[model samples]
Target: MTDIKATVFIPTYYGEDNLDELFTALSTQKVGFEYEILVIDTSSKDRTPEIIKSWEPKFKHFRYETITKPEFSHGRVRQQAAEKARGEYVVYLTQDATPAHDRWLYEIIQPLERFPQVVGVMGKQDPRTTALPLLKEEIIRTFKQFGPDFGTTLFYEDDFIDSQQLFDLVTFYSDVNSAARKSVLLGDVPYQDIPYAEDQKFGEDLIRHGYMKAYAPRANVWHTNEIKLRDYKKRMFDEIVGVRRVGKTMDPISILFVIKQVIRAVTLGSLFILKDHQYTWKRKLYWLALNPLFVIEKWKGVRAAIAVDLDDEQTIVKQSLESNEAIAHGKQ
Candidate 1:
């Protein structure tokens, strides 16, 4: 019998800033079963290795491996982690995503333990306090669609009428705070070698192949991108391009389309800011005035990304944040 009940796996790049808190939270998990914390580092130039070493003595089963930056691909690296993991259930977490409470590990892995048909489970993500107003609302709104924050929901192939319905209702999976059965990860539905959206693709494959995926709302983590204004367009470009790479089609860019989208986004965003109680009146007014510029930048990014030739890797690399970071670090 396997002594390790679960493996909490994390992939790190320049994660020195987030690793200390994350390790502290992981070390104090309120769990009855045995588990291991395994980290795969992409040769981070920061103090990530030092931080990992500092936390080694805090856990009974903690270890990490290093891979060159150039060798990292989201799906491939994660699949490698699964192969190295010794637990019956492998839980994936990004280095920057911190568990909100001590029970996070237990809560995320429970559905996998209790439900035989549930091959995978995803936890809720709450935005960090420093998150921008738009991003904060989007995070909350996105997770709320799965179910109540305190409840659990499961999705299977039989629940939907068609592939489109399934994609629309249940294909949204995230590795930021998620768990999957070890047998399934190493079997027929292993992660594909994709540049982006691998998590959602895995979810689609699981549900299509007659397995269930679950959402445990209480398994919460803090995650968000505190994007600066100058980088917002690049961020949006990466996002839409990732969606396109996953086989989703975007509307063809046109003058009328751009005009309509910007106007609609600004109007709705302005109303949200005005109605939100989290922001002070001055902040609300600031966002309202700035909403138009953000909306315009968003549409411009979306349009440019949609027009990109999927075969042209050079052009996509220029437009996306993923490649830019690698290039900045001399990894690409």
Candidate 2:
């Protein structure tokens, strides 16, 4: 009879294997407030539908719907789900990300309620048991790159002195394990219709609106995608394009950037192998040998994505934010 305090929105495709654990974890969350799970499935071919149906009786406020892949737009579909959500906060999670603890739901939404200035909060991601050794090390390195206090860090618009730092923070926001105010997401700062990185685009808008984005170390999830060399390269390309689209800067691809990043990767990989006591020398050497190939693949991907002509931008990429906003305002 009462509206929920939070809505966990998940857009799932072929996620049958993880659905059971994910729902079980959600059912046992130890939050003080009431919450519901809303799943928008893109017609998964596996047993995902049956798995979801089996759990419906267990969850008091579970809801589900199926949509065709052709009808899906990452930002648009998620926005549609938010529009239908009846909660104070909208929490987004990938189907594979299981709650690290029962306290995850409570901790993830704490920052949003604690500070009016904060519009978004992202949770930490721990590697799953199946994560490769190299991938685990990569995840740890990424967290450290955020800094010593990355666990509970907050990014404010005024704190950034340079455009690059601001861009870095904007693009770093991830929807994998994040929460946002329902009012903010649906009313003032909704996600833009970007093809690849709508989370980053939404984050850019949040920062521009003078809002804060938080990193909740206490709210962590077990999530990882074991990407191979080729997939990693493709991911890098998409990321580079996403950055360019949101930044609206047509700065040409830099040869210096490629060189610098490759060198840095080599240096860091070597240092990590030399210092880490967890792995045997044979394993370290194997990773070191693969590191160069990984670096080269990523560099080539970045270069390729950047070298595309702007005249073909519209055909290759989705409609721009300006176009989306115009459509929202009935101006197109």
Give the Cα error of residue 187 in candidate 1, in Å: 0.5
* lDDT accuracy of residue 56 in candidate 2: 87
TM-scores of the candidates are 0.91, 0.82
- Superposed model 1: Cα runs more than 4 Å off: 163-166, 253-267, 274-291
Query: For model 2, how big is the CA root-mean-square deviation?
Result: 6.1
lDDT (10s digit) by residue, model 1, range 1-332: 64998999999988988889899889889999999999989988889999998888888999888998778888898898889999999999998899999999999998998999999999999988655666777899999999998788998876445666446568788999999998999996788777787887888889878899999999999998756676677788888887788777767778787787668657877787777777888888788777667667767777889888988988888888878888888776
**Which candidate achieves the best TM-score against the true structure?**
1
Considering summed lDDT, which 10 consecutive residues are worst modelled in model 1?
159-168
State, as a TM-score between 0 and 1, how close model 1 is to the true structure. Answer: 0.91
